[model samples]
Target: MQGRLPNGTLIAVKKLSSKSCQGNKEFINEIGIITCLQHPNLVKLYGCCVDKNQLLLVYEYMENNCLADALFGRSSLKLDWQTRRKICLGIAKGLAFLHEDSAVKIIHRDIKGTNVL
Candidate 1:
């Protein structure tokens, strides 16, 4: 869902089932890793909240959704080769930053079109 914090920053919140332990861990890990990272291409993670059993990830709203949505959805045809290349480069740079720039090496473990956003 779309929401705004007290500071007036726009955010997109994704709700996940608490029953999936793996999913919850990935969600928490992604939030933790992304919140400490900043990049022009990667989606900016603002903050997150854990309310009892619910997990809320607050991210800067992207005008466009995930890379998978742009690559395979109805709007897929709209992204030209150049745009696709840019996306690929951006994802690579983000990954490089995670591995080389950060103090601690992080293995994304899961990297896919959807996660590229």
Candidate 2:
């Protein structure tokens, strides 16, 4: 879900999939973790929604969306080797920050090309 703030800042809203069965604790923890991290390669967490039946996380929008969409979507856009390598490097840097440089070590439970942007 893409949206813009009143100040015109673009953002992507992620709703915790009901299938994940994530409770409020997980949601709050995620927010806390995200807020504590500071890295260029990682998406910025803007805020979150915890209203009634809603559990949404707002993040900085990636103009290119995700890697899966670019690779599998019905688009003719072709990425060169350099672009792909840069994406991989960015992912590596982000993971390294989470797993090594951050104050709290974070082991990402799931990682997929679709999760990259």
Candidate 3:
């Protein structure tokens, strides 16, 4: 779900299923990592809300949605070669930074189209 903060910042809210322990771990790990890291291409995680059973991850909303949507959506606007190249470059740079620049070496196991938002 998408929402706007009091300061008018758009955010995407990802709700985690209470029954999934793996989902819970991913949610916690994402929040912990994102709260400390800052980069231009990476999605900015604002904050998270953990109630009695529900967990919601609040992130800065990307105006264009995920890269998968831009590439494969029903939108008439098709991504050109140049735009695709730029997107790949951005993803590479972000990954490289996460691997080499951060204090902790991180590996994103779920590197798929849907996750590349």
Candidate 4:
């Protein structure tokens, strides 16, 4: 879901579903991992919430959405070859950082169209 901060910043809120396989431990791990990484290609993690039963992760909103939207015609904007190439390059750069450049060597277990933004 999309929401506005007290400071008027538009943010994306990821509320972990009750039926989701991921638990509180994994959520905390994600917060820890994302907080340590910084890259233009990677989505920014602004903050997170763990209040009683709710597990919400706040992220920087990307207006363009994700690659799945473009591929499956869910997006309004038509992507050109240049745009597609850039998307590929951006994903590659992000992976490179996670795989090599970062102090902690972390592998992204899930990499898919919907996961990329």
Candidate 5:
């Protein structure tokens, strides 16, 4: 969901899918790990909500959306060689930070354009 903070910062809120097999356990684990991660290349987790039956994770809004949309979606944004290289480098940096630089090692099982932004 798209929302704005009181200070007017745009954000993307990800709510836990009720149909997900892993419930609160996975949510807590992700919040615990992601909260400790700090990197320029990574998406910033602003906060979360676990009130009553709601479980939502808040993230800084990405202006360009995801790589899949940029490359294939109806959006007319062109991906030149330089832009593609920059995106690739950014992804590499983010992955490197998660795998080797972060406090805990994280092996991301899903790595795809849809997941990249």
Candidate 6:
């Protein structure tokens, strides 16, 4: 979900999907790992919370939404080759950071269209 802070900072709220059965410990660990990394191509995790036993992640909002939406949505907008190349490069850089450059190496459990923005 997209929302604004009291100070008017735009943000994206990610509520852990019920479909995901990750325990609280794992969730907290993931949050910690994410908070330790910073990259231009990676989404910035602003904060996290366990409110009423529900996990929530606050992140910097992307104005254009996810890559999957741009590729498959009903919108008629078309991306030129240059734009597509940039997106691919960005994804590569982000993945490289997670896999090699970060303090701790990470093996992304899932790589799907909707997961990339």
RMSD (CA, angstroms), candidate 5: 1.8
**In angstroms, how far off is 18's CA in candidate 2?**
3.8
What 10-residue stretch in candidate 2 is worst by lDDT? Answer: 69-78
lDDT computed for candidate 1? 0.77
lDDT of the candidates, in the order given: 0.77, 0.83, 0.80, 0.88, 0.86, 0.84
lDDT of 4 by residue, 3-24 (tens): 9999999999998776667777
Candidate 6 total steric clashes: 0
Score candidate 5 by TM-score against the native: 0.87
Backbone atom clashes (below 3 Å) for every candidate: 0, 0, 0, 0, 0, 0
lDDT (Cα, tens digit) per residue for candidate 1, span 5-85: 888878899876778666655677767867888767667878777777888777888766677877788454478899888
Per-residue error (Å), model 2, residue 34: 1.0
Q: On residues 6-71, what C-alpha lDDT tens digit does candidate 5 reach at each position?
A: 999999998876666666766778888888888988889987887656789999898877889888
Of 1 and 5, the candidate ranking higher by TM-score? 5
60-83 per-residue lDDT for model 6 (tens digits)? 988766778778964455788998
User: Candidates' TM-scores?
Assistant: 0.79, 0.87, 0.84, 0.87, 0.87, 0.86
In angstroms, the error of model 3 at 43 is 0.4
Residue 88 miss distance in model 6 (angstroms): 0.8
Among all candidates shown, the one with the greatest lDDT: 4
The predicted structure with the larger lDDT, 4 or 5, is 4
- Lowest summed-lDDT stretch of 10 residues in model 5? 17-26
